[model samples]
Target chain A: MRAFLIFTVFLAAASAEHCYKEIEKACDPTSNKADSTPINCNAKYGAIDGVQSALQKYVNDHIERSFEYLLMSTHYANYEKSREGFEKLFRGFSDSKWNTAIDLIKYITKRGGQMRFPEIDSEISSNEDYEMYELQSLAKSLDIEKTLAVEAHNIHGLAARRRNEFHDPEISSFIEEKFVHKQADDIRALSGHVADLTKLLDGRDSSLSLYLFDEYLQKL
Target chain B: MKSVVLATVFLTCVVFASAQLQCAQKKPNIPTDWIDMASPCVKKMRGQIQEELKASMQYLAMGAYFSRDTVNRPGFAKMFFQSASEERDHAIKLISYLLMRGELTRDISHMIKKNLVVPKTEWATGVEALKDALNLEATVTKKIRDVIKTCEDPKDSSNFNDYHLVDYLTGDFLEEQYHGQKEIASKISNLDKLMDKHGALGEFLFDKKISGGE
Candidate 1:
């Protein structure tokens, strides 16, 4: 019984750690466009000279980004909503959801449209109101922000140029209200949620439970 | 004796040659602090969230005691205890996560205790606190991703078995995002309706809604 149990354990271990070669074989994409690399699918580490060593960084990077996306989605949503409510209550702003719309647009431009920008753009553009008009104009400037925000072959020059891009009062005000100030609060809230979920997920096993927690509560 | 010695040397040479071939095939730097990089940051982040949840739990508990709603007072107290327990569980899990990663956990008890200052009256304050929690999950999700990246960087190959740490962390991160993205946000978005629907039962659900319905 003992020998059988030990053998079973070994078999389980073997199957569980069935390295990249096996993963690669199982997950062949149909088109040649399927670019499979170590970054895409590999156990982050393997034993090297009996020492554990990780070969790739993509998994970690993706996981981190996924969390960041969750944070941005939540906090920015709340911050924009709160700001809208607050502005309506305090600042006498006509559109309560203006900052949120603008914030989403800026996020899409900067972070590659994680929350469906085209749909958002149409939504903003189609809204026949003065606030929508102002936000629509802001959306047009996203191209310039993208341009001035990035540069080929130089980080410092790009920073300097982007600084010039925001030299305009309208752009500066939009950024300050929607992105910069709002981002700080969003970031704080995101950090708190990250902490909570990290603690919860780290403890639990079973993907099903994790999935449920994520689906209903965490909202990742 | 001579034959045995020769056989041993031959076996050693074969093993050495195989290992050499493997190493020479892929030259990825193994970092010493890789595990530390992944673990310490995660631990730190987990500590912060645990603290917030703990504080929120205490606040709710205190709020329940103070609120004049006698019908749900006992229920709310029960919910508060459950929340505190869950937060404690989270703290333990954070510690376990650190241990699994072969990293030491910094003492976060004091920090958590200090932050546990919730309002005594949470009839409405609890709702606000829950909103804060929803927002908190969003923030933590971002930092956890950074920790995963830091761990996976080709440069730092720490000694702790990072074999599936990536998958584990990835799974955890996805779960985190889901919890925040779907569940809490929905609750906060529909807070007014939820409050109106359950009445007394709503107080219990609002106070104690576990992620997995557990």
Candidate 2:
């Protein structure tokens, strides 16, 4: 009876954590996609030595960026009547970043990697001198988006290269699925903003334009 | 929108490259901190944000409980989810108000609170959950009142009574809290009476009403 109970528990766990490779169903239409998603909570699934830690670093970075977005929002708070709009944009961005970090942490845990509660870095990334102007702020934000996109692209590349070793592909695919496309959308959106802001400001500081531009940002 | 097109054309600037914005330069920094509220107010305000967050999480849990297949009360789930969203908005409003007071250094630095625990996950009936929500709003109201009490009193040794913060919470947060509490209590009373008469069928009908029978 004791052996049967233990066997049942083992069976349940085995069904729970079926590895991504193990979930390959023959004659499925998605064969070409081969999207590296785990079908079960793979108990034995583990990553290459450095891949999980690298993913951990990005998770921490996203968490840090979330606060940075908040700090940026705070800086924009004292601007004018437009503070409401800037406040809306940065706070929303902050929430979205935190949500992304949360997703990454779950993925890490799912892949059998330990999530490190690393002591948060206190440094904020907003440049008070540069970001004061709406145009400048958008440009700086565009730069941030560009940096994050590049980093996501690079990590996705890393995961893809390491896929030959088995567990690395799943890590790569997780990054690709979660981070890559979002970064692309963010970059596109921010680039549009930078262009629009540049056109609106045209090397001049106009209070009315700033307020109007901020209102537009609030919607996003 | 027509006026916007012409404005965009005229506003287009022939300035330094976008790359300059990425780097450091001496363009005058305009800070928003017109007045920094006292330290004590900052602490209390931060605590209130956490309280709001806790209430949001509890509502979220209640929503999930009602959403479960076994308990499947869509009306209750919808109401709780809406309440959760409302609570989150309240937290954001408090945070924004705190920032508006130019006390960003203390509050923004300690931004998110960790490990928010929702005390209740399951309920015996719809009345039980409604009662829990009523209790929650009352607790939140009391917390807001306590913050107001400390901020308003001159003898607290802080030597600074933040009239603006006190007025803001009382006029805004307290008003919302009272309305919310009254609505929840009324619902509980109605649900109790209905459940007592027709049992689960009454609950089913009440749930429809709560979910906006329209």
Candidate 3:
């Protein structure tokens, strides 16, 4: 019994040491952390040029969208009745985009890539998005959602195809694990809103039904 | 038929014009609110939210400064970035509270463009940055107290004194401010003592003790 307990303790220690080495291997391309067996950080995990640029571009895109949503959220919040609903919707989108961008930023550094985010001008409103009513703005937001979903899908395909040359499956796995489904979820929710709103008004933009819809949206 | 064609053109033009101007609701759209939280109190909260956001942007600037190639102190960079994120979270929490109280908030996202102007990017040293952070925490603490006072107004007819908001700000925001101030102060003093003995090298080594670390 004592021998079995000792064996278990030894196993735990070995596993812990292996985990530490794995993370240590994650950091530097110079030297392996383990004395027992060395792993190449750069050769194993370094993103190819194409993949790195794609990820960087994707991050930049998300950052732009995040700022765009921030503007839209504030624009919606200015209205009288639908303020609560549209504020929650657009602000939630902005938060999600910011989070994904930050995560991708960290992941880029992990893969030994430097980011070059172009300074975005905060003046995003060239169109009349500011004056868009609840249903109209929602329609626009749905379009944004569709674009994001399509982009995520395209990137997933790109990452998968690129993994044939280099062993960097992590990028594909990340998009698959983190983004693809989330984008789908966002699209589903936004599309639902668009359909409901369009049907609620029955092709009319101005109606009492819009106010009624606002109350329902506030609950969400 | 001539009259019908002219009417069709007129109707099309009318639709185009109204599409641009139709955002203005024809009917009254009065918002519903269960809570009696005064607009003054709500406005104060929003103002404080802007203050928190400004501080966040300032911390982000400090983080950027420390991360620069000429002044590469990853420890300080990491610390300031953490503070930036924390300040942002504080603003988010306050905003969430406002939403929960059923108080409507105006579009304050314009503050992003207004508040992100960081005039002094380069500090003399990490020590100077630490002092600035300490001072910032003190100022934010004072602001939080002012918010509490506004919320705790006895003369307001609501008579609830915005007790929940006061309790929340006192408990959560002020606690974080005090703890952060104390930590920054200790870091500054300890570094001062170290620098007196060993100068620049001491400051370098002192920065290595990064609670908000790489």
Candidate 4:
């Protein structure tokens, strides 16, 4: 019976040690105090700082592009023979870009990261000819969106790779399922739209093409 | 000995509970990108801020016009100056709103620095200046309405129908804008009638009244 008691005490001590070890592993030293209960900071996940900075820049770029579209709309509105269709189209594009930026900001904040605001250049030069100016603007926007899509893909890839390094299957799957795959599909669709716009601009009359573009954007 | 075992179990439970509580204190996993910074309503608000600043600048110009020795209407000048300050305050409020919502306001600052040209430097008459002021106020009212409309659902499906923004704008701004526009219109009508009935003497007296002189 004495021997049985000694074994029982050893087992209890071992169980307590195991429990304490598990708790210590989860508790973040920076936030957890020795005197108080350990605080878990599992929210700090892979390559967060870098990913956050990139996302912030991406948000800024989207806002800047939105502003550019706004300028384009204003230009079309003010032109001698105002192209209402073009103005409407540009306005739609501006709204779309702005929404995307907001979506990005929302995503970043959801991840427990602070947002950084970027300065935008609002000066846009207007050409004498509305058609040429608008075509150029559309093309410029296409290039910007393409670049943005690539940047987003890269960030997603980085997050995935970091999750792998940390052996964090949950985060890896989350990034893949939530951001990376969806962004890829979105970029592909946007690229197709850009191609369609380019083709339309090349073959059609400026007025009809602009009107069609406005209709197409409205549908989007 | 049985009591000691119960005590150990109780201590274990206590430690676990404390740890769980500490973990629970972690901030809610709010995705930072939840607030759409680029919503149409938000963009309109951003534009409105610039418009407010422009209106303020125009008011300052009107003030300067009235304050001139030849145009000596201290009352009109003082009124314009006050209007200008009020418009500036409106712009600041918009800026604060943008910041609170985590939207960027730096672009407006840049736009103001690079693109803001001076308003009409000289007015032909006090009536003309007041007319412009009325027009400015009207434009601002329309823009505020547009902002409120954008905040409403069905216009932009993506918009969150942010009631707080609607409340802030309609509650504080629209009322003031309406009141200001009405006040300017009244002043213009009164000035016009005084000019018609009393001629140059009426105009002189009106100027004196505006200037706070007997």
Candidate 5:
């Protein structure tokens, strides 16, 4: 009887730990005095720094696996698994979180626009016809660079637009022509490096939902 | 005849015990719609935190871009950097919280793509900004706490183990509020001391120091 009772207690403990591994990870050791893991820091809290990583991780791992299976699927079982994963990921958000994420996604896509470039060195000595041909040649050489430059430019424009919309700054000619313009150029310059790389890459294409979900889910 | 009576009594007790167990172990029933609705609030809070982090980073950058030690007072740049880092941590924590809740988050780039600027003409501006930050933190704390309490209210408390989450979030809000108030108070007091020692020179010193970070 004594041995059986001890075994039962040990099993209960093991189960509890299995169930609350994420909560244990986030809990501050010094403050969470009641238990090595606090009961409160479970999936219910849904806050990120607290225990959200664990849940997200759990969701992410299974989703990825489902994706992998779905990618290779020839059977009904695989489809069901993928469907289940998709639904769970979709349903994971509370109404507020879903709306916010959708809004952000919409904002990003909406902000995607053509970014214009400033005129380069107009003073180069050449005949008008020669200059036109030379300009075309220069443009051809800068095809890849220009694409990246455009993206960088657009991203900056988007960021500036966001900033402008936030505070109703007086769109004075001086301010608009000088400060905001300069700021936009600076943004383009800052993102110039990454934009260049993005243009070159053509690797695996993951959906936005999958990417975001996977990033957070792996932690759960 | 005696065995039958005993068996009947045993069956009665078993039924009573099963009923008691059912009452004690009632499964939680969280409202699905509520979860969906509340998700946006969490996302908005996250967006706000991202905005704060961007502001803090801009402040640090401004200090770095413009100031020199001889021109400005000591420690202003360090303070801005510190504040910026803390806000970044706060943003990360917010993301972690959402991830834990199984809510998905896209890149902050989508929500906050622009470089935020904090206009700083002088040293006291940094201090004033810190005070404003503390007030914002306090506001966030209240809002998060209220969210938790609302979740706990019996009227809508059907979600299984959501109460547990509320409890955890409450702890986080308290800790953040403490940090915000403490840092703001410290910066304000430090600024006051600098003012007493150098007057206008002290003020300019702080401006260059913070605006042109060390």
Candidate 6:
């Protein structure tokens, strides 16, 4: 009985090795097995290409947001009156956006995807309107948040679509749980903050209101 | 045992035969219009490269001005010449990046045909030259920023942004611009302080200090 068990184990191991060798032969083009069948991975290749292209575009969006925030920071820094609080806020946002871009690139590379760096235009026209009141700047900030939320949604949709098409459960869960849901939560929280700030500033131009808002943002 | 071994070999051959299908596809030719070299942002970058070259020429002219027998400021001449080389290097870097991205036109002769405005060849004083150089650096910084801005999506309603291009610009160029401006500003401040202390004698002392490689 002991000899029989040992022989069974040996036979299984040999069979598995033979299967691995067959897979290796399929991968090699120069192998002269006339009767050998090929396994087409064209569908997988197409899926990868599609996802990579979308991810590249997504990366570009993140970079644009970062640059926009950077310009906003510069405006606050260089302005004669100088709102240091707003400058810090914009700078913080810019850093976050930049990091997000890096994170996305890392994720793509981890998945064996090639990254193509796109050319970017970094000028911000909104920065030219920096002379506007604190309320207006906040409005602009809200607009940025809204745009980011939309982007997050679009990315989520792409990931979900790819998952459905390719039946990639890992990518689906990763996109939905890690990115989509998180972005949605962020959008909700940001919207609430923007609304509260808008309400607080309604019919008020006092330095006190501005100071309070700045303080609130600093805490956030 | 021999029967088991023969059966395994037979299974492996059968599996290989059943799995056979052509995996290799003909290599697709790349489309000529695949890369958008004439995109507004790319065109702006190309123009900025020319601006870099022009800046290099201006620096060279400044170096020549300081090297004149009448000027007799070897240190200033050396500094300006180095600045010129740095600017030329910046232009070359931009060109190389563009080429890597297939954004630059293949026609090298067309790239050579630049309508660069000739830079002023003379400065009334060292202070004047320093101020001009500082201003030029600031302008170049602004131009670089503009290139970055051009990468942004113009359609306000859309969230599409060019992250890759911005990354390249910020990573490769902007830090250097900031540092260059800061250095020039410091030099200007020092020159101003020196002028305040000595008047005509300050200029004489400043020249001597610079010429001594200080």
Q: Indicate whether candidate 1 or candidate 5 has the larger TM-score.
A: 5
DockQ of 3: 0.08
Candidate 4 local lDDT, B50-107, one digit each (tens)? 7886786567556655654445566776787677667766875785576567555223
Winning model by TM-score: 3
Can you write out model 1's per-residue Cα lDDT over A123-188, one digit (the tens) per residue?
112222221111121232233223322321122222223443312233234334544444354345
lDDT of 5 by residue, A103-130 (tens): 2222221222111111221221232111
Model 4 scores a C-alpha lDDT of 0.62
Error of 4 at B17 (Å): 44
Which is better, 1 or 3, measured by lDDT? Answer: 3
DockQ of each: 0.01, 0.10, 0.08, 0.02, 0.01, 0.01
Ten-residue region with minimum lDDT total, candidate 6 chain B: B106-115
TM-score of each: 0.30, 0.55, 0.57, 0.41, 0.35, 0.41
Error of 1 at B45 (Å): 5.6
Q: What would you estimate as the lDDT of candidate 3?
A: 0.69
Superposed Cα deviation of residue B33, candidate 2 (Å): 10
lDDT of prediction 5: 0.40
- List, residue by residue over A1-220, the lDDT tens digit for candidate 6: 9999999999878654664666688768887776455333111322444466777667656656655565465444432324577767777776676557655655554554543444332234432443344556556776877776676566555555635344344454656665666566656765676676556654323455666766777677
How many angstroms is residue A168 displaced in model 5 relative to the true structure, after the best TM-score fit?
35
> What is the per-residue lDDT of model 3 for residues A143-204, given as tens digits with 9 covering 90 to 100?
88788778877766776774555435677788788887877887788789877876665533
Candidate 2 error regions (>4 Å): A1-72, A78-86, A94-184, A191-220, B1-36, B105-107, B154-158
- lDDT for residue A61 in candidate 4, whole number 0-100: 69
Candidate 4 to truth, TM: 0.41
| Residues forming the 10-long window of minimal summed lDDT in candidate 2 chain A | A121-130
Model 4 agreement with the true structure over A181-217: per-residue lDDT tens digits: 6556655765675666566555424456656665666
Error of 3 at B34 (Å): 16
Query: Which whole-number lDDT from 0 to 100 does residue B32 have in model 5?
Result: 38
Tell me the native contact fraction for each prediction: 0.00, 0.04, 0.04, 0.02, 0.00, 0.00
The list of candidate 1 runs beyond 4 A from truth reads A1-220, B1-77, B105-129, B153-163, B173-177, B188-191, B194-214
Q: Candidate 4 chain B, which ten residues in sequence have the lowest lDDT sum?
A: B19-28
